[model samples]
Target chain A: MSAKIMGFDAYNFNFFWLMLLTAIEVGVVAQSENMAWATLIFVLVSIGVVKFIGIAAVFMHLRFSPDSNVLTATALFPVIFIVLLVLMVGLTSPSAVENLPAFCRPGYYGL
Target chain B: MSDDHGYHHGPHEWSHGAPHNSWAPIIISIGSGVFLFFFAKAFTMNEGMNGYIYDSAPLPLAIAGLAIIFAGLISWWKQDFSFDGSYEPQATHGSTPFSNVDIRKVGMWVFLMSEMMIFSSLFATYIRYRTSIDSCYSLEGTVVEPGTACWLPASYFIAKGGEHAHSTLGFMPDALVPGAINTFALIISSYTIVMALKTAKRTDLEHAERSIKVRNYLGATFCLATLFLVMKMIEWFIGFHIGPFEAPSLLSDQFTIHNDAYTYNYGHGAEAGAMTVDIRMAASIFYLTTGTHGVHVFAGIVGLGYMVVKAHKGGYGPGNSVSIEYFGLYWHFVDLAWVAVFPAFYLY
Candidate 1:
């Protein structure tokens, strides 16, 4: 059962999808500006997903090991990193102090 | 305790780490750090002063560092050395806890993961800068003559030019077409590497020969990559010579190399460097990002060169193709980065 499961072939997986996305991104960037924006975001998200799968599936050899704990650790690490980065950038990127309109400039605000 | 049950030994264990008196790796590390630090400092410092001394240090340090690394590799490769009194291989504390396949593959993957981030940060920057400028340009009307009645504020000029400004309206014609061709070359190389891995997995000598054939194809791919690097360098030199910033093309008048302030088009009879703002931010960033990636490609080529040397010595096969696979992953990642970079930097 383990042998069978280990060698089981799924339909096109992450690497395949990644290459496809690359081509699609090239096409989108070339033709449509709107599509280009979507493609850019999509590619970044796709890269994160594909890297997660590669690190977990191949590097950890979970297909052979069947360790549930290993799977959890591998997936959790990336999620935590991403979430932390997002939280950091979200809070800091929009600076109320710097971004205020001219009328509300610091001197006039009497702070 | 039963003889075997109380303490089971494994092939992966080795007992050499703490007792060993090897000073090579530490020395090499320090030497490399010093060399890179000096090299970077040289770039930031004035070219006239202390340049001679700083430039001289790196080459000798690099050679000595390589010598130490080579000595370590040779020592590691030797079969006679062992922690146990017996010459025969033993299960001890320092033995690598990985099959060669696993260790090398993991190493490669780890390497590629870092590389992916490097490329990602660059692409992300390009996207942010491009979107900001695009929105600004559309919001404000067509860029017009500065200091005229209709001229925008110095702050406005400074903000546009101060932020991510572009050095050129579009990429020079030569750079883009060559870049596209190289993209195709990289894709083809990825295909060839897959074939090499497939051939290595076969159980026959003919398959081994086929593996060599595939490796040769891989080498060809490297050659193509090298050619692409050469073409890119040539393109950069030509751009420098032509001065992309000083002149203007049909699309927009606001681009230059040193700074990206709004400049009047040369065709529109504006003087060289005439502008309320310098708008070369986009182009400079574009060059720096792509140029750094190009350096990575060059490093990958060196790795491939080493792999080719080992391949000739019969060091790789189905059991040992992890290095090849990892490098292939890196090569493709780079190509994919360029795929985004070319369009984002050039087309938009």
Candidate 2:
């Protein structure tokens, strides 16, 4: 008989699926060179999902735990930190000057 | 398995609370922090690439930190706390073992938290580049202006020919394909580790002894991690093929320093000059972030070897397999981080 869902080793199972999804997302990103930025964003979010699943199901040990608050903080804090950090970095960086005629040539703009 | 004194307070007794309370880790942390501070100052100060003069302090500080941490661990070894740190029954009675797990796991979680921040910063930098052809196009949402001077320094250097002029708009290096292959390798390793964990949890000890599956899993993870590093080195070598094409642009510090643009407005029969592809910033940061992760993978390889040795020594099983499981968690964490990193930095 299959193991009971309630008693299933959710840590291992979720990690397995998360890794598989991560592999698939990597393939998608690899092959989607011609895809739109919006579609790329979608792929990124999928990657983010896999990341969350790994963190939630394993590192925080949420699958076996009874407390959701601990899990929520554990999972949410890194994300909040990432968002805040990205925002801070974005705000501090000088906006790229798009008006220069030399901007688009490969080696003209430092980027 | 959840016995409070046995699992939690056991290691505390092993070290007798004496060795574990040393100031070594704090000193090590501070030393490294100070080194990083000075290192940043060295860069901002523009200390003229004199590495022998400037890098001396940071290197020593890092070495001192390593020495301190290693000494502390060495001193703490083979003591009462060596066996089971949490459950020191005779001394510190009624101190629940749950308290130990709480702190220990929380610390690991926090360390991983810092790791996330580090990688994210790199990813954010990459996103800025992937979205824009140039700084102007990046901000103003306007189409890239045509006929900018293309610097082909790298091509000139590598091709051993007179400067060939071409447009820079459509230049791309083929780094993504091998990177993608490495990505798959890590994924496969993660699966193998999970399989190992599964085998460890099974009831048959004799079968587990004979199977050698966990050993194989750990070995595979090590191989894949090494493969990723090798491929990354190859990618850097490929960047060298473009000569000055890999140099950063002179226009900005945030971007790669590509050669200075010299405009030539020859009318009618003028062909567009060859614009070099500057892969320096992209390739450098790519290596830094991913390379650091690769070092961590190497460390994990060592950790896995330790785990395998201990497993052979019969230190882990279904009843007391938390150590192996924690290692598994860390391995998977590394894999998950790469899933985002690969696309964000390379494919996108």
Best by TM-score: 2
Q: What TM-score does prediction 1 earn? A: 0.57
Docking class of 1: incorrect
User: After aligning candidate 1 to the native by TM-score, how far in Å is the CA of B343 from where it should be?
Assistant: 5.1
Cα lDDT tens digits, model 2, B1-348, are 135535533334434353335565566466556655655544332333112234454556556655665554344332312333232222123444233343435455667778778877876665444333342213222322343322222212211111232213123323333555677777677766766666666676665572366666666766777777676555444332243333222222222232223232222344433222333444445556666777678767756765566555554455434445556667777876776666555554
Top candidate (DockQ): 2
* Share of native interface contacts recovered by each model: 0.01, 0.16
> What TM-score does each of the candidates earn?
0.57, 0.64
* Residue B263 C-alpha lDDT in model 1: 46
Error of 2 at B260 (Å): 7.3
lDDT of 1 by residue, B48-122 (tens): 321233455456655665566556544533321222112112233344433222333444445555565565555
Candidate 2 per-residue lDDT over residues A1-111, each given as its tens digit: 112244666545655666677666655654454677577667777777756665555544555444335544764578887887665653344543342234334676475
Query: How many clashes (backbone atoms < 3 Å, residues ≥3 apart in a chain or on different chains) does model 1 have?
Result: 17
